[model samples]
Target: MAFRRKNWMAGMLLATTFVVAPLANAADRVKFILDWAYQSQHSMFTIPADDGTYAELDLNVQVDRGAGSGDTVAKVASGAYEMGVADFYSMLRFNSQNPDNKLMAVMAVDDRSALAVASLSATGIKTPAELKGKTIASPAGDASRQLFPLFAQANNIDESSISWNNISIELREPILRRGDADAITGHLTTISMAIDAIGMKRDDIQFMAYSDYGVELVGHVVVARPEYVQSNPDVVRRFLRGAVHGYKKMVADPQLAVASIRKRDPMANADIELARLKMSLDYRMLTPNVQKNGISSVSPERIQRSIDQVGPVFGVDPSTKAADIYTTEYLPDRAELQLPPTGPASSTP
Candidate 1:
C-alpha cells in the first residue's frame, strides 16, 4: 500500500513539472506595426532587431510597415498587436475614442519634426511665405493635416488660401507632375525618397523645411499599452536597450545600415536613406548625449507645445498634462546613452 501511494505522488510531481517547465520555456511574441513605410526616419528601430538584443530578452519580434500612425493605434487598441510605432496625435485620438485603450510611448523615433513641405525646384517656392494659393498634396486625416495649416499660418501664409489635394503618398509625385499640386507637406524621408525614385536631383526640387513653419509636432514613437507594459516590463526595458544600441550603431555606420534595410525591401531607396541619416546627424534627433550620456529625452515643453497646437483642430484639450500622454520610465542606464563620436555633426535640420 505504501509503494502504491509513493508511485502516485511521483506521477503528480511529474505532471506539475511538465506544466511549469513549458511555461518557463515559453518566449513572448511581439509584433510592432509601423506608422508608415520604413525609412531612415525609423532608423532608431534597427537597434532591437539586428543586434540580437530582442532574443536576449526572450522576445520573438516582427515589424510591419503601417499605412498610418492611426492604423497602428487601431490595431494596438484592438489587442491585435503588442506594440506599434506611431504619431503622438494619433495616440491622443485613440485615447479619446477607446475607453479601454492603454497605449503609452516607450521611445521617441524621430523626436524632432523633420517633416517638411517639398516643391519641385523650378518653382522658386523656397519659403513658406511663397506657398500662398499653391496646391499642397497630403494624406487627408493625417495628424499633419491638423498641424500643417497652423504651421502655414505661423509662416505668414493664409492657411485657407492653400488648396489641399488629398492623395496617397504613392500618388503624390504624380500630382506634382500633373500640376495638380505645387508642393507636398510630408515626412522628410518621403520627400527625399520621392526625388530618389524618379532619379531626380535635389537641384531639381525645392524643399521648404516645415520647422520654417510652426508644425512642432513630435515625430514618431514606439508605443505599447499599460497592461502589456505591466505584464512584460522586463521585455520592454530590454527592447528599449536594444533600440538605443541600434541608434548608436546606425549613426556610426549608415552605409551598412542602409544596406541592411535594402536587403529587406529590395525597392528601398538607399540615397534617401543616406540623406535622411545625414540630416538626422545634423539635427538633434539622436541627441543630448551623456556626461552625462544617455538616450536624449523629449522635453515636456516641446511636447506641450505640440499638444497645445493640436487641441483646437482635433478637439483635444490643449492643457492636458504631458504626463497624461507620455511616460519615459523604460530608458537605459548611463552607460547605454552615450553616442559614438560623430564627425563634425551637421547643421540642425
Candidate 2:
C-alpha cells in the first residue's frame, strides 16, 4: 500500500500554495460508480455538477448510476471505477458469501440507518405499534426486509401478525394510497419522494422514522478497493476533500442542493433533499461525534466491536482484520471537515 513519498511531499507543497497560487483547476478525469440510481443524499458526489467546486482539486468526476451494492463492490475491487457507494452491511454479507472479494470503505455518508415504516396520513397510523396486523410492502431479499423481524421485535410489534407483500416502488405508492397495505418499509428519503409524488404535503402524512424508534444502524459509504487506495492515495484524498465540502454546503442549504439535483436529473427526487438533509443533521450524520472529535474517525475498537457483533451471523472469522475493511487516511483533516456550525436541529418527516 505504499506510494512515491516524493510525489506526496510535492502535493503538500501544492496545499501550502492553495491561497497564494489560487489552487489551479483540477486536471484529473476521475470516474465513480454509485450503488444505485441518483437522488438527494448524493450531493457529496454531485456538487461538482452543482457548482464549479471540483476544478480546484484538479479533479473531474463522472458519476455512473447502476449496479447493485454487491456488484458495485466487485467492480471497485476489479478497478472498474475509482470509487463506488454501497450499503455498509453489504460488505459483511458479501464477505460471508465470498471472502476474497474484499472492498474498502472510505467515507460513510450516513452516521446511522434511516429505515422506517411509512404510512399515509389518512389512515391515522402514527407509530410502528399501529403497524401491527397491517400489510407491509417489502422488497424480497432486501437486508432491511430480513431485518424487519428484529426491528419489529424491538418495537414490540408481533412480527407474525404483520403481513408481508413483496413489492416494488411503483406498486408501493399505489398500495399505500389505495389502502391495500397499511404501511411500507421505507427509508426517510423514500418517504420524502413518496409524499411528493402523491402531490401531498408532508404534513398530510404520518410516518414513524426508525432512528427515532431507536433502530439506528450504520449506512452506505463511499468505497474503493484497497489496491486502488494504494495506487492513488492523493486522488482519493482530493475527491473526499471536495465531497466533504459538498456535504457541508448541502447540510447548510438543502434548498440549494435540491436545485443541484434537479439540474443533473430533472426527475431526480429533489423533494427528498429536505428530508435527507434534516434526517442527516438531526441524527448527526455530518456532525456525529464531530463536536467531540472529528468526522470520519473510526477507532480500531469501534470497527472491531461492530465486527464481533456481526461476524457470527455472517460467518466471518472473529479475528478478521478490522483495519482491512476501511481506511481514514484519505479523509480530510480537522480544518477540512469544516462542518458548518449546527443550525437549529429538527426531526425528519
Candidate 3:
C-alpha cells in the first residue's frame, strides 16, 4: 500500500510538470530594440521587463540596444525586430521610401522633440541662424542630421552654408570637445549628458532645440510594422500596457528605474543615467501636452502640423497621411498612463 501511495505521488508530479510546461512556454516572446544604448529613458521598458510587469501580461520581452533611430526603423520595417523605439520623423522618411513595408508608431513616447544643435558657449552660437557656415558633426543616419534641413528652413539658416562632418556615434562629443566641429546635432539630453560625462558642465553647452526654432516635431516613438501590428494587435496592446506601467513606475521612483539599466549593462553609470532620464522627462517626455492628454496620446492637429513640416524635407509620398504613421489602438487606457504627482524625482541616487 505504501508503494502504491509513492507511485500515485510520482504520477501526480509528472502530470503537474506536463501541465506547467506549456503554460511556461505560452508567453508571447517579443524582441524590443531601443533607439540607442541603454539609458535612463529606457527604464520605461527595462523597469517593467525586470519587475514582472511584462510577465503579468504574459509577455516575454527581450530588450536590445539599437544603433540609432534610422537603424531601428529599418530593422522593424524588415521584421527583424517586432518592435523598436525610434524617431517618428525618421520612420516617416522610411515609410515614404518603402510604402509597401511601412512601419507605424504604436505609441508616441517622447511628446517633445529633443532634437537640437548644441555647441559650447565659446562657439558664440546663440541661435539657429548662427549655425550657418559652421561644421556640424553628426552620424550619417542621425535623425537630427536628417531633419536639419527642416530646421534650417524654419530658422532661415541656409542649409548649404553648414558643412556636415559624418562621424561615428562615439565621436560625436569628442569631436566637439576637440573643436573638430563647431557644433553637433543629436538628442539634446544625450549630447548634454555626454558633454558632462567628459568633464564639461552641461550648463556650459548652449542648445538650440528644433522645437524652439519652429520645428515642433515629435520625438521618439514605439514602432512596429503595420502588418505585425494588425496581426498581433493583442500582443501590441499587452506590450503597451506593460510599457505604460513601466513609465509610471519610473516617474514615481527614478532611482529605481536608473538602477534597472545596470541589469542589462553592468558598467552603466547610474548617476549619469539618472540625470539623463530626468532631463528627458523634464524637457521631452513629461511635457504639458503629455501631462494633459496622458502618455502615448497625440493631437490630430499637432501630428498634421508635423506631417506638413516634414513632408517637403523627406519628399514623403504625397499620399502619406498622419494615420499612416501612428495608431492609438494599442495604447493603454488614459488612467493607466497618467503620471503621478511626484513625477521624475528620486529619494536617493
Candidate 4:
C-alpha cells in the first residue's frame, strides 16, 4: 500500500511541473517603436497593452517612443526593434536610397496625410497663398518640413520667398504664439498640443491641410524589415489582430483609450491626449476613402498617386518600383478590420 501511494505522488508532481513550465514560456517577445514621443496619437498601441490584447495573442511586447519617423525606420532596419509606426513617405525614401536594406508597410493607420501649414488667427495667414513672405517655423526633422517643398510646388507658393526658422518641436508652437513666427508647418494634430500645452484657444488657430491643397500624401504606416516579416508572418498577423481590436474599442469610448495612454505615461495630460486622438481619427485616419474601402487597406490608384507625388520629392527615381513600399500579405481578414461606429461621444471632441 505504501509503495503504491509513493508512485501516485511522483506522477502528480511530474504532471504539475509540465503544466507550469509551458505557461511560464508561452508568450513570444516582440518590440514596437512609435514615430514620436508618447502622446494621445499613439493610443492605438497603448490601449491594447492596457487591456491585455497583446498578451491574449501570446505576444510579450514592449512599446517605446521614437525621435522621428525617419529615425524610427532606421532603428527597425538596423534590427534594434522588430516594428515601427512611421510616415509611409519616409519609408519609401529610405527603401529608394537603400534597396539592400528594404522595409515594407504592413498596415496604414492615417490614410490621409496630416501634413499642414498652421498659424494663429492673429497672423491672418489662412491660405497657402498667404504663406509667401511669412516667416515659418518647423523642426529640421519634421515630416512637414521635409515635404514643404512639394507642398509649395503643388500650391504654386514661392518657397524662396518664405524665410525658414528651424525650430525644435518643443518650441514650434510657442514661437508661433509669441509672434516670433508668422506660421508653422506640422500635422493638423499639432493644433491640440498648441491649445493644451501652450494654452492657446481653439478658435485662435487656422490650418491649411496638404490634402486640401493638392498634396495627396499618405500618413503613418506599420513597417517591418522584409526579413522579419518573411520569418514571422504569423507574428505580424497577430499584432494586427490586437491592433484592430484596440482601435474598435477606442472608437466606442475614447476616454478609455486615453486612460490607457496615461497608464503608460503617467505624466501625460488626459484631456489633451484625448483631443489629439479624436482629431487624428477624424482628419487623418477615417477619410471618405477609408470609410468606403475599409481600414488597413488603400486603393491601388491612391497608393500609386502617393508614390508619384512623393517619389520625386525624396529623390526616389521615377523608375523605383511602388510595390517595394507596401504589402497586404499579412493583413487580418476584412471582417475584423471594420471599425465600430463613431459614436456621438467620440465626435464631441
Candidate 5:
C-alpha cells in the first residue's frame, strides 16, 4: 500500500506540471515601439501594460521608445519590431518608396493633425499666409516640414518664398526663442511644451495650426508589417482591444495616464505630462469625429482626401491606393471602443 501511495503521488505531480506549463507559455510575446520618447500620449500602451489589460488577452507585450515616426515605420517595415505607432503619412511615404516591404496602419490614434508652425507672439505672425518669406526651423524628416507644401498650398503661400533652416529636433524651440528663425514647424503639443520649458510664457508663443487652413489630414496610427499582421491577425485584434481599454481608462481618469508615465520615468514632470495629455485630448485625440465614431476608426472618404492632399507633396506613386496605407479590419467593434461620457455630470443640488 505504501508503494502504491508513492506511485500515485508521483503521477499527480506530473499531471500538475503539465497543467501549469501550458498556462505559463501560453502568452504570445509581442514587441511594440512608440512614435517618440516617453510622454503622456504614450499612456495608451503603458496603462494597458501596468493594468494587465494585455495580459488578460494572453499577450505579453513589450513597449519601447522610438526615434521618430519615419524611423518607426522603417523598423516595422524591416520586421525589426512587430508593431509601432507612427504618423500615417510617414507610412504612406514609405509604401511609395518601398512597395515590396509595405506597412499598414491598423488603428488611427490621433484623429486630427497636430502639425503646426509655431512662432513667438512678438513676431506678429498670426496667419498661415504670414509664413511667406520667413525662415522656418525644422528637421529634414519632420512630419510638419514634409507636409509644409500641402499647408502652404492650402493657404496660397509660395513654398519657395519661405527658406528652411534644417536643424536638429532639440534646436527647434531654442532657435525660434533666440529670434534666429522666424518660426518652427512641429506637433503643436510638443513644440508648445518645449517652448514653455525654456521659461517662455504661454501667451508669448503663437501657433498657426495646419488644420485651421483646410488641411484635412489624419495623425498618428498603429502600424505593423503586413506579413506579421497576416500571420497573426488574432494577435493584432487582441492588441487593439487592449489599447481601446487603455484609452477608455485614460478618458475616465487622466490622472491614471499620468501615473503610468511617472512610473516609467520618475524624473518626468507630472504637471507638464498631465498638461500634454489634456492638450492632446483637446486638440488632437478628442476631435468631434473621434467623439462621435469612437477612437481608432478612420473614415474611408477622409483618408482618401488626405492621401490626395499628401500625395503631391511626398511624390507618392499615383497608383498607390488609400486602402494600401490604412485598414479598419483589425479594429474592435465601435461599441467596444466608445469613450466614456466626456461632459461634466449634473450637479446634485
Candidate 6:
C-alpha cells in the first residue's frame, strides 16, 4: 500500500510540471494600440489577434482601442505602447515636430488615403469644385479636414471659396441629412457611420476619394517607437509577420474579420462593420500598387513626394526626410504579404 501511494503522488507531480512548463515558456509580449475605437477597418489587427495568428508567431499581443491617429502616435512615442496603427501623414508630422523622439511606420496599410467628402446623392456635391461655394461640416481635428489644403490644390479648388462648419463628430452627418450642410469631410469608414445612423441606402451616398483627384498620399500605417525597434528588432520582424499573416486571412474572408472585431467590441453592429470592412478593402487597401508590391510596402518616389507635399503644409522641419517617416527592415517578403481576393461570404456567429 505504501509503495502504491508513492507512485501515485509522483505521477501527479509530473503531470503538474508538464502542464506548467509550456505556460512558463510564454510568447513575447507586445502591446498594440489602434488609431480609433474597435471598428471594421481595424479587423486586420484584431482578427489576427483573435484568430491566434499572433500566438502562432509566439507573440502574446494585447490590443487596445485609441482616441485618434494623433493620439495613437503620441502614445507610442511616449512609450505608452510598444506599437500602434496610425495615419502615416500624422506620424510624419509628429516626427517633424519632435525630431529626436521619432516613430517609424513599419507598414503602409493603405496605398491611397481614404480621406473624402461624403454627401447625400440628393445634394449632388460630387466634386471638390462642386464644393466651392458650399459649406462643409466636420470636426476641427478631423484628418480629412487637416488634409483639405492638399485636396483643394489637387483639384484646383479655391480654399477661400468654401466655408468650414466646425462641429462635433456626431453632428456632422445629422446636419448633412437635414440639408444644413453641403457635405462632410471624413474618412470613408467614419462617414459610413452617419449613413448607417441615418438609415441611408448605399446608392444615396457618394465619396470623392482624395486619391481620385491626384492627392498622392499613403494612409494608415503600423508604427513603432524608434527606441523599441532598436531594442527588439527580431520582435518587430515577428510582429510584422504575424500582422501580415492575419491581414491575408482577413482579405480572404472579411466576414471572419468582422467577427473578430465583434469579439473585441460586443456592442458593434456586424452588418455595419461588414460593409465598412468590404468598402475599405475595395476602395482603400486593395490598390494597384498594393496588389503588385503587397500590403505594407510603398514606392520610394511617391513617399518622398508625399513628404515634400505634406512637410510644408504641416510645418515640418526642413531637415526632415522621407526616410524618417518609415522603414522596411522588419517587413516580411512581398510574396508572403499579398492579400488574397475578398469573396462574398459572412461569418457564422
Best by TM-score: 5
How many collisions between residues are there in candidate 2?
5
lDDT of 4 by residue, 1-349 (tens): 9999999999999999999998887887789999988877677787778889999998988899998889999999999999999998889878878879989899988887888888888888878898999899999878788899888999899989999999888888888888899988887887557656777887888878787888888889999998999899999999988887877777678888878777878998887888787788887777666665668768556777788888887887787555666787787888777765553222111
* RMSD of model 1 against the true structure: 4.2
The estimated TM-scores of all candidates read 0.84, 0.78, 0.90, 0.91, 0.94, 0.89
Regions more than 4 Å wrong, model 5: 2-25, 344-349
Instruction: Report lDDT (Cα) of residue 173, candidate 2.
Output: 66
- The sequence of per-residue lDDT tens digits that candidate 1 reaches over residues 1-349 is 9999999999999999999996897767887787777766465665567667677777677877788888898898787888888877788777766746657777776656666787877788888888888888988876656578677667877878888889876887667756678987776656666766776776777766565456666777787888888898887887778777777777777886787576667787787678867776565365442212345467667777777776676667555767766767777875677666554543344
Off by over 4 Å in 4: 1-25, 343-349
* Candidate 2 residue lDDT tens string, 14-76: 878885563454377778888766666677778765577777787878887755676777777
Q: Please, what are the lDDT tens digits per residue for candidate 6 over residues 303-332?
A: 788888877888887766667767887888
For candidate 6, the per-residue lDDT at 160 reads 93
lDDT of 5 by residue, 103-170 (tens): 98899999888899889899999898788899999999898999988888888999889999999999
Arrange candidates by TM-score, descending: 5, 4, 3, 6, 1, 2
Off by over 4 Å in 2: 1-26, 49-52, 67-71, 121-130, 156-158, 253-256, 268-294, 297-317, 320-322
lDDT of each candidate versus the true structure: 0.72, 0.71, 0.86, 0.82, 0.87, 0.82
Error of 3 at 195 (Å): 0.7
**Residue ranges of candidate 1 with Cα displaced over 4 Å:** 1-25, 40-47, 99-102, 269-272, 280-284, 287-294
Better of 3 and 6 by lDDT: 3
Q: Higher lDDT: candidate 2 or 4? A: 4
- lDDT score, residue 257, model 2? 70
